[model samples]
Target: MMRAADLPGVIPVFPLPGALLLPRARLPLHLFEPRYLAMLDDVLKTPHRLIGMVQPDPNPRAAQEDAPPPLHSIGCAGRVTQFSETEDGRYMITLAGISRFRVTEEVGGFCPYRRVKPSWEGFDRDLARSEKDTGFKRESFLDLLSRYFQAKSLDTDWETLKEADDEMLINSLSMLLSFDPEEKQALLEAPSLSTRRETLVTLIEYALRGGDDHGLLQ
Candidate 1:
């Protein structure tokens, strides 16, 4: 568990739209782009070795601007838990999520990659497991999930999925499913584990009913 003070005041951000990382989850990344490769190199020398995974706002106006695309206010910070340099000079790394943070202000024109002062005060719950015995509709979720897999022609080890704990199941599905950027961001910003689970269920149900082309395999 990281205390508030222990968290970095400013962290480098990787603004990947639709890629989401939740606290206690692991997100594997291939760092090939020059700016990101440089970001990782700088992180290696620092003690924190942390990177913020944020999503770029999808508005067309935001995209048309000369500056980098605007980012959502919230994102999860992850520690570089695994790292290896390939002969081709690309970095293969796995980040273990630490906590969620809200960007208070962007500190610009310094690093090639973006940096922000993050506020961790509102997301202390991310540091600890949820104590609320918020029950999950496992059978219903799995049933809909099975339908979703079949619809998308996706394969999975049902035995392993069944064995996953509640938190793991919810977070894993949230990460693995091909949701739109806004939907993924909504999951990341959910106030609690229970709320995320509920939101996931609603999204899955919407997909099952053929609500949006974005929910289909992409």
Candidate 2:
């Protein structure tokens, strides 16, 4: 319901590792932590009702045992589209992803939740529902996916996966797969649908070969 121009310069952030929310996808979150519960309450009072879904930066150099881990620079902002309060005082909510943003800087505030100044310059196109991945060849990709899933001892409906469009098939897999945090970040930061698909293929190929995390960046 919020327009692109209405997005704020500074927004609240939730830095949970391994959670990937791509544009046009919905991420369901169960909020029990006091800070995040407060974050949900505060955002619901706003017109935009959005929060940045970012991952904790996994690089050892960016972290210290005594302090909170640094957040990755890039993340997607999602608007809360559904909400319900549980009897236990927790919140169950669904976020409909709007666009990706880069963390320009962390804002110091008294609010319990983290906030960051977001730069939404390069991701305006994310407002659209989907994009064409001209290079996507469905049949072969599914074959590779079958092999990877079998190796991981995972089961999925081949028909369901095959029926998804280019963007949905790629983004859903990118979000749902059990890839490491760094790889999930890479998928979230991919410049286009084609790039994400290629990265996904490369990842699955590596996982089939016993998962060389070091070589994924190469």
Candidate 3:
């Protein structure tokens, strides 16, 4: 029930790898590190308890470093809707994605994790409009994904996939696909569900044509 206009537009940050949070999606996090545990504490006490979810680059050594990655300029801001403290001092929290935010500036010294002032001019406005399937493009996108998986011999539950809702299909594919960081960011920043759907179709087609020339499907 928090008002968007009243949000501080800034809050403490938690960076987790392989996590892509989209507007309207929910992310469950296990908070263990001292820095992030303190972050959970501060979030629980704040009026606008939002956290920016961004992934670190693909490096085991880099991930173990004490600092967060240089985050992509754009990320989704999600409010801590569910929280629980375990007996072992860890935290289980779920963030309900609210809006897309731009990192305006970083604030230091709150905790080991960083904080940022966000710009949320076009947060979740897409929710007001009905999402329309772009017809042939979507089907083609699914076909490409299917063929790519087959070509790579990856096992997936096609029956379950076929029954997924539009949002579920698009977001799950976007998350599950081995897209590069820049491409993934593009999907994150796409203004509308339709826009993201189109981008996914394009990326899939590119992968189909071997334009990526990498082991994306594998």
- Top candidate on lDDT is 2
Model 3: per-residue lDDT, tens digit, 13-59? 66665567876677788989988987777777987778888654454
Q: For candidate 1, write residues 10-96 as lDDT tens digits.
A: 899999988999998899999999999999999989888999999987666656547777888899999999999999999999998
The number of the candidate with the highest TM-score is 2
By TM-score, highest first, what's the ranking?
Answer: 2, 1, 3
Q: What's the distance in Å from true for residue 119, model 1?
A: 0.7
The ten-residue window of minimal lDDT in model 3 covers 126-135
**In candidate 1, which residue pairs get closer than 3 Å at backbone N, Cα or C atoms, i.e. clash?**
none
Evaluation by TM-score, superior candidate among 1 and 3: 1
Model 3 regions more than 4 Å off = 1-3, 55-69, 84-87, 124-130, 134-138, 209-218
Preferred candidate (TM-score higher): 1 or 2 = 2
Better of 2 and 3 by lDDT: 2
Q: Compute the lDDT of residue 69 as modeled in candidate 1.
A: 78
**Candidate 1: residue 117 lDDT (0-100):** 91
Give the C-alpha lDDT of model 2. 0.90
